[model samples]
Target: MKNYQLKRLSDQPILQTSDVKPSIDGFDVLGAFNPGACIVNNEVILLLRVAEAPGARPGFVKVPLLEEQNGVPTLIIKEFPEPEEDFDPRVVTIEGKAYLTSLSHLRLARSKDGIHFTVDEKPFLFPARMDESYGIEDARITFLDGKYWITYTAVSEHGPGVGLAVTTDFLDVERIGMILPPPNKDVALFPEKINGKYVLFHRPMVSDIGRPSIWLAESIDGEHWGNNRYLFGGRGANNPRFAWEGGKIGGGPEPMLTDEGWLLCYHGADETHAYSLALALLDKTDPTSILDRSDLPLLSPELPWEREGFFPNVVFSNGWVRWPEGSDKAGQIWVYYGAADDGVGLAELVQS
Candidate 1:
């Protein structure tokens, strides 16, 4: 029952809301976090989930969304009267409809050392389709089939679902539409085909009978996914030893193949909604079989920045990349994570 430890690369968050500029005129960048990291042509590229919203007015709650008018996509702000019901600062409920205080879109941030990044002024991928009317978020990048396959969450009136996009070069992208439907998110593809099929890990949210947990799915074309199998963290299927994730758990970064097995980094939340990172190892031949997992969290909200922000006591990640060949830290894994939902931080995964 050994614990996995991680080394914090820096004392402070690498990127914050203030470092990003808003895509829309009236909106301001609220947060920049949960970026998908990969190396393209020797540079570390991060597809950042940039959350933005309009400033609050006197008596109205503001919600920002992407709307279509005359076949053109437009960013619009919707206002609702303050409600009597209990509401979260990030989400407001008005007459049975839920609206987000801010909308999220993916933007590009490039880095030479994988620490300091220069963010693009404009959004690299935004809500253009009907399913993404709310916005896109938490992109997970996997380079497979000679292209970068981005699996992300698309939010709309329907709820959060998994969407796919492909790119050979970061400058251009092609949307493959929504693959997994509503109540599902935290999707990440395995870097290579397994058992002659594309394998992926996703979290299908549960409300009534079960808990939100990780699931495995298979695909032939990488666009259509099926053969769902429950992996961990649901009711009755007890994983009590991993009680830190007693509330819910989900897949994080793309799994990296190792000599022992496939190394997985996932996030979990407890009853208090405190988020932390954990590790697991799955059989290389049959990923459905879990070999070993972290009994305790690998990384948690320890620093002030990680303990406070838009969402407090949260340290979530969807991205990690091995320090490239020839670099001083070549063998170590660099994890890019969202700190308290407001800023980006870096950590080195030390498997002891």
Candidate 2:
């Protein structure tokens, strides 16, 4: 029923959660979904992923820490009670320590017509240092050789790693820290520079040392990575055949090379975390191989803002915006997802 050409763009929420004052102190700014899209001079750029809280609920847990005190930037808040209701509910352990109900950073959006985005009042990238002190999340922007090379998702308290930053004019940015550490993340790279080296795609869950899937690394010098393999995972854990892609599968946005080879727009989830949107096709010069995919979904989560907010049906993405740039046999891609994580959805694949 949908082979791609699903356009929703924006009914609301291009970016939210910003009263400016964030150094802690009451908090309140709770959404702004994942982004990391790009285009640069032609416009359409989004690095968005802003989440803040104070009254963040849903089984409880809110921890945000980032300090500088007298030098300025500061944010600290940690609260966890009620024995730590596990069994999902977005995790909130207590004595053993665990957090994350909200608090993220990196905000900046602009669009010429990638679908009307224009966010930028504050937050260029927050949570500075101490391993990102519990904030900073899912970015994945890679332009390579010329400049633009983000790769976010830092989160502190010693978990969820994979951070690196660089910008030519996203207004001076250059963090570049943990390449792929604690639990890894959907780190992405590979815009150019493949056959010679530097090609990444991370997702390392390390539950006991396995099952979280999606790997493939190689770097001549894009920040000291190693040579990990894997690729895409999910056939167990939750992909009971494809219970909507079974619960875990990542590596979305930032892959697109095209000529019918490196498209790769992924993001699946099932087992109730319900997020969808798929597309795969690699092997430009051996992008770890893989040929074609999208056995069913090219997008899902049926409207209603992708089925209600704060993570309902989900539909996450890291970025998109393709056009007359090397012609993938067609033109106009535009993607940019993140609906039901609450806001940010724009479709348009169009490849004839």
Candidate 3:
């Protein structure tokens, strides 16, 4: 089998921390990455995951938390004693618990050429529900049933849950609440129904017995998900040859229907927590049947920007757009990835 490779589009990141402004006055933009890509009205739309944190005070370490007040989510700040040494900017570890240094929200950006984008000043989707007290992140959009359905990770003290939302014109959005609750994320809906049922791919993190891996589920109404089947697990440290995914693996963008099968681009991390992208092909009818998979990464952190940032050595994605016919790059895949959890980068998936 020929190896799949991704052609990195630009030398610099497409969207960076500095390019995005914070939602709150005192907060600073930490990262703007992991966008969900789709085409609407002949334009490429990106729902960007924007991570922001407040400015550090003299002696106290402040963290932003969203709390529901009278059924409405409100942003609040909590202070903790500053750590003397080994201060990590991404997270604050106190006692045995951990708190994220920044809160993430989804913002919208549009590009006519799929390269340069005009970002929105405000957030498209933020922490509103109680389950999203920590943040809403890593959205995957699927245009099914005449509406744009979005599945994102809603995080809180409860853990990461899958939340659903729907939009018609991207102007007004309606929340469908949490579907798959806690210890689960990286959910992406299939663009079309299979065998008269809606299908989706999700990742459920395991703590005690098993490792975090990909799973497949089906739904009748697209809201209540069931009939789950274990799809596959990451090739962790046990596999010396494919140790790039030694940590965990999760679903990425919506599956693309191909002549060969259902092509899925997913993310995996090594023992060192270095994330990379890989491809898998599942049976078109029965998605549970895996046809083939990449033994090596299609995209890895090789460049300086991808190797060094808020979280180093990561090239994770939840979104990609197939260049439409009649366009300059028809039938090709344009992947939008998060570079080291700090900035957004673009790549062309040159299938081999």
Candidate 4:
């Protein structure tokens, strides 16, 4: 078996310490940033997971906003009061109940270079309705048929599901509603339609029936998805310590098509929640057929920054850029991932 190793591309964090607020007034914390990557127009865009704490009151939760307070730049937090236990810290509760500890919203940032980024003043995406009252996280972008398709996680008291959104430009997005609901997420759309239908990679969590594993689905119109099947599951064989990736494996970035097969870069997490990057190959025509997979991780939590934070021992990627054909690094892949849930990290794949 050929050993696959992830070469660190950037030592410094790419997207770190976001300043976010809810509405015009709210208390803001250094929000967690992840799942950011390069897009069209040579602009590097980021989908930031903004976290805000409530106000100092019994039932009031604070939402943070960026503004000038008495002549200096300050974060303004808005307070909202609800019944006791309305905002649960552990799980999501809705309609006179508690919900996820922190409300997550998707904020945008743009950059000329993949490193330094400028956050947009407004949030690019939010939980407008009940199904997504819990918030959205982990956005994967794919440009297909002239439009960009974004697949993200929709959280609510019910459970975690997959949501879809489409946009030609980042300015405005069309919400396609929840495509895959309840107990599913980590969706990545194939670059192009297969056999006149769209193909997507997803992971469905089943604690009793099965473990959290990657799956595949097909759709005619990007909105409606069906025909689901399992792609892969937990690590085994001569693979790395099973405990390191025992919980689940998820699709990451867009799969790279090569003469060998579809090269998929994915992340696996263990019981401890430590994450590492691994690779797999799928049939070009039928992605469900596994051709080869790196038993061990291509990248893991080795860097100091990637080994500690909100969640320690994690390196998660959602986006990457592939060089055009004919170049020296034609098939080289650049991945942008989160480090220990604290900040962003970068890595590059040199195709052999």
lDDT of 2 by residue, 50-149 (tens): 7777766665466666756787657776666545333444456667777775678888878675666677768888877777777888797888898988
Model 1 agreement with the true structure over 1-352: per-residue lDDT tens digits: 1545778999999999899998888888889999999999878999999998898898789998878889877778889988766779898878888888899999999998888899999999988888898889999999999999999999998899999999999999999999999989999999999989999999998888878889999999998999999887722236666566877789999999988899989998887888989888999999999998877888899999999999999999999999777977788789999999899999998757
Better of 1 and 2 by TM-score: 1
Among these predicted structures, which one has the highest lDDT? Answer: 3
Better of 1 and 4 by TM-score: 1
TM-score of each: 0.96, 0.32, 0.96, 0.84
Candidate 4 wrongly placed segments (more than 4 Å): 1-4, 18-24, 55-98, 236-241, 324-331
Runs with alpha carbons beyond 4 Å of true place in candidate 3:
1-3, 84-87, 95-97
Model 3 C-alpha lDDT per residue in residues 1-352, reported as the tens digit of each score: 1456788989889888888878889899888999998999779999999998889888778888886778777889988988887777767878777788789999999999998899998999989878998899999999999999999999998889999999999989999999999989999999999999999999998887998889999999999999999999987658788788878999999999988889999998989999999999999999999999988888899999999998999999999999889888788889999999889999998856
Ranking by lDDT: 3, 1, 2, 4
lDDT (Cα, tens digit) per residue for candidate 4, span 307-346 = 8776678898888877556545555667888787667777
> What lDDT does each candidate get?
0.90, 0.75, 0.91, 0.73
Q: Note the residue pairs that clash in candidate 2.
A: 134-156, 238-246, 239-246, 247-270
Cα error, candidate 4, residue 52 (Å): 2.9
RMSD of 1: 1.8
Off by over 4 Å in 1: 1-3, 71-73, 234-241
Give per-candidate clash totals: 0, 4, 0, 22
